[model samples]
Target: MKLVPLGDRVVLKQVEAEETTASGIVLPGQAQEKPQQAEVIAVGPGGIVNGKEVKMEVEVGNTVIYSKYAGTEVKMDGTDYIIVKQEDILAVIK
Candidate 1:
């Protein structure tokens, strides 16, 4: 499915948390919390800020960290993705 953000919003696919512990031991799904890291699947063209248009600092394929409780869950072609604003994006990972 194609995603076109309306404004300064972004659509992200949730990245799964570690399936194993730091010691290389595998952990069950019940042991993990919802992963807050996400991949930038799509982004808006820009948004209106002040009297000018402010473009998004993010792009597709960027891995970023965002607020855990932010964004809305959406399903596209049976895949889950989150929709959030740029303001909620904390940082971009290397």
Candidate 2:
């Protein structure tokens, strides 16, 4: 399924946390944290501001770093997804 975010919102397909360390230390399933990193798959058009449209800072295809528990959880075609406002987004990771 494909989705487009409404004004100033974005949809991120989460990148999962690695379960093992480089040194070969394995992490328990429950012990692993959800990765706050994500690939920006879809973006909303610029949001309205002061009666004028404000362009969004993040764009589709940008990788971003967000709060660990920032977005609303959603599921699409068996894949987990997150929806967040552009204002809630912290930074676009390099």
Candidate 3:
């Protein structure tokens, strides 16, 4: 099954966290922090939202950084994804 966002929602697949520290010490899975970076999988068409006109600034294949506690988590066919509003996305990684 595939995810198709509606309104101003965006679908993202998070980039895996680093398993090793900069010093080369391998950290266990539990010690790794969830990365805020994610690749844009799908984007909702921009339109009127809450009395304001919204425009989508990101696109598929773009890497973005989102708020730490933003978005809803979903699992499909063993793949994890996050669905969030466009406003929840902080910045696009160039």
Candidate 4:
């Protein structure tokens, strides 16, 4: 099933974390940190939110960095996804 975000929500698929350190040390799965980078999968249409006009600044296929603890985790057909608000997205990778 495809995820369709509503309001100002955005759907993202997280990028894979590096398995090796800069020093070339291979880190185990448990030792790897969750990546803050993700690719935008879907974006909700911008509209009035909390009585304030909101406009979407990201789009599908855009890579973005988000807050470390933001968004809700979801699993669909074995694929993991994050659903976060536009405000939670800190920056869009150029």
User: Top model by lDDT, which number?
Assistant: 4
Name the runs in model 1 displaced over 4 angstroms. 21-35, 49-52
Which scores greater on lDDT, model 2 or model 4?
4
User: What is the descending TM-score order?
Assistant: 4, 3, 1, 2
- Full-model lDDT for every candidate: 0.78, 0.73, 0.82, 0.83
lDDT ranking, best first: 4, 3, 1, 2
Better of 1 and 4 by lDDT: 4
**For candidate 3, what is the total of clashing residue pairs?**
0
lDDT of 1 by residue, 1-94 (tens): 4989878889999777665657432323333333367899999878685556877999999988777465888898999999988878888988
Instruction: Please report, as a residue range, the 10-residue window in candidate 4 with the lowest summed lDDT.
Output: 24-33
User: For candidate 3, lDDT tens digit of each residue in 1-94?
Assistant: 7898988999999877565657432323333333377899999997998878999999999988776465899999999999999998888878
Model 1, residue pairs in steric clash: none
8-81 per-residue lDDT for model 2 (tens digits): 77898876656565643232333334336778889888668556686888888887876545579889899888
Estimate TM-scores for all models. Answer: 0.75, 0.71, 0.79, 0.80
Clashes of each: 0, 0, 0, 0
| C-alpha lDDT of candidate 1 relative to the true structure | 0.78
